[model samples]
Target chain A: MNPSGLDKEIILNAAEEAIRRFGPSKTNITDIAKILKVSHAAIYRHYENKAVLLEAVTERWLSRVSRPLEPIMKENNDPEAKLRCYLKTLCQNKRSSVIEDPEMFENFAILTQNSKEALSTHVEQLFAQLEEIIRKGMETGVFETDDPREMAVTVFTATSRFHYPAFAKEWENPNIESLVNSVIDLILNGVKKRN
Target chain B: MNPSGLDKEIILNAAEEAIRRFGPSKTNITDIAKILKVSHAAIYRHYENKAVLLEAVTERWLSRVSRPLEPIMKENNDPEAKLRCYLKTLCQNKRSSVIEDPEMFENFAILTQNSKEALSTHVEQLFAQLEEIIRKGMETGVFETDDPREMAVTVFTATSRFHYPAFAKEWENPNIESLVNSVIDLILNGVKKRN
Candidate 1:
């Protein structure tokens, strides 16, 4: 035993770097141990297994993504603008993350590919944020009446092309901004109180 | 050279069956020849290369898909009905194709993955069909005014989740039909003429 004493934070960092370098399937706890200069047992103490470590890393990523949106969600701005900003920011965050480090993002994708429950939790958080804005709009007579939870899902699914990583290749197109704007307008017209 | 005389139709049939059995990458011209009881050179005589053969198979698949939609496009129904029917049929066609034999669909996906040009041609045909309906709607004042081509594209992109093969896993959800109906409601609201 090296007995050098490794923390979970340090192990998480090494795991992320290792995934970036080797892709998901090739990355392993043993590799992270090598990077951390500790025994595999030491790493295992912090993260019970590969799946556990992956979930932790994914949770960290989701929290980082959620941080910027909290202000937009809590702000007293018009619900329409808040909803628009929330979606635009969400799309931008995903697109930029994919573009900034494509290889790393690809590895992350493989790691999360089968973790349906983990990904679903992240989406549930998004739905909750959207539902809040939707509910407020419905209450203030600014938007049409509908189930806030359902409307939130419809809006999110409607703009899937812009925000979904599967469609990220299309994000680089010059017309993507207008496409997002057009979809937003379509959704607004759908949701707003129409006479 | 086993010049037993193979036609393009025969070769395409063999190639498609081969792809379905072995997937795209694992499938090769030699394997197709083995299936056909002929020399690879005999198969090559009809198609210049594997890329050419794959494109032929894709074109055939796309044309088969396009056949059912032609009647809906040509029908003199209201533009709104036409648009709704067109999009619904498109989504159903895709979902069924994915569901009926997922393995074949998966193999087809691999064959067509990198052939962006081939797939774009199919989408262009879909767009053209959609644009026609939108133009008719605009002329009759039944729908809101916009560039028909642009609006057609927007509608197609917005409804991508139901139709795109990437989300095939979600197709099994029992609520997918209702989700689709809600989206159609949203699109109609977005496009219909307002007072």
Candidate 2:
């Protein structure tokens, strides 16, 4: 019998929880199926194996988290505003309020390796979008950069500190907003103080 | 029979090679013994177990690599010069020229966790030394920072990108020196363009 739409969603949610608890290395299909109160075969019918199931879970999470960026990227007429919003979203999401689970972040390295084509496409799309914003900002004399792609990568990498596990304790401090703003200002205006 | 000094060194070297080749997860004592042309019991005499052998190997590697920093930290009077030199050394030694094995880099993460207390103490001492330099710079009105410890962490983290695997390919370019210099400049002088 074909699993219902709800069955797939339940299985995906169970898999996400299992992977988070055990990491990609230790997680198994049986563990996920048991968590869902379903048979392992039920999961195999919906998804081929644990790898594909984990991949689907990752794709689902990315879609959910990245959805808000679509409207911000599309509707904002000003490239600088769009870029600032994107950076803010990335930094601010470090807080508990914005992120429901921290474990979702761990799967990215494994997911990136296991599904290189899909992950690369998604990352390339993000870089391309950021590059477009940088190009527009340069044309408007808002951003000073000779190479937009390199600058985009630099910006992305700098902001990635928010997601790093090492920074989680520090991110809880009250001054996190100011710290994030300082980092953003350093990138946008350069760190050299204007005389 | 006790292994000779030469035999012990050979076993340790072979174990290092095996760990590098197979990674910590797959490496076995027998594999190391086979590589060294010795019985596995000889390795047990020297190391007690694989874990202890790995720890010794890691400690040996760190001691050899970190030896140069001692003289610079102790003899250098200028904090900035010491900091700059230390950072340059860190970036330069990302891959040990003497080892000629890329696998050593991958095996290091395993060793870092294997000897947490020793590694942590060593890192703490290094950070403390860096913090002193930062504090001295601030006192001399050469460095602009309210919190020397936080500033040290920021500098260390940002400069560490030079040693990251992701940046290894890009670092081979002739411009990497200038790129690292720019990052240092930004940390010390801020990034804003002067009028």
Give the true-contact fraction for every prediction, in order: 0.59, 0.22
**For each candidate, what's the DockQ?**
0.71, 0.18
Ignoring the other chain, what TM-score does chain B have in each prediction?
A: 0.94, 0.75
Give the CA lDDT, 0 to 100, for residue A135 in model 1.
Answer: 91
For B23-113, candidate 1 gives per-residue lDDT tens digits of 8878899989998999878888888898888988888877777778999987999999998898888888888898898998777776667
Residues A1-195 of candidate 2 have per-residue lDDT tens digits of 234443777888887788778887788998887787767777888899877887787677556555666777777577767787877875565455234555566454466456756665666766777888888887877666667886676666555455433345446667777666665655555421243
- Residue B81 displacement (Å), model 2: 7.5
- By DockQ, the best candidate is 1
Q: Model-by-model lDDT, in order?
A: 0.83, 0.66
B71-137: candidate 2 lDDT, tens digit per residue = 8777747666767787778767764432365556657655766787667666676677778878877
Q: Model 1 residue B140 lDDT? A: 88
Model 1 deviation from native, Cα RMSD in Å: 2.4
Regions of candidate 2 where Cα sits further than 4 Å from its true position: A1-58, A70-85, A91-109, A128-143, A164-193, B1-56, B68-88, B96-99, B132-142, B160-195
What CA root-mean-square deviation does each model show from the true structure?
2.4, 6.9
| TM-scores of all predicted structures | 0.93, 0.60
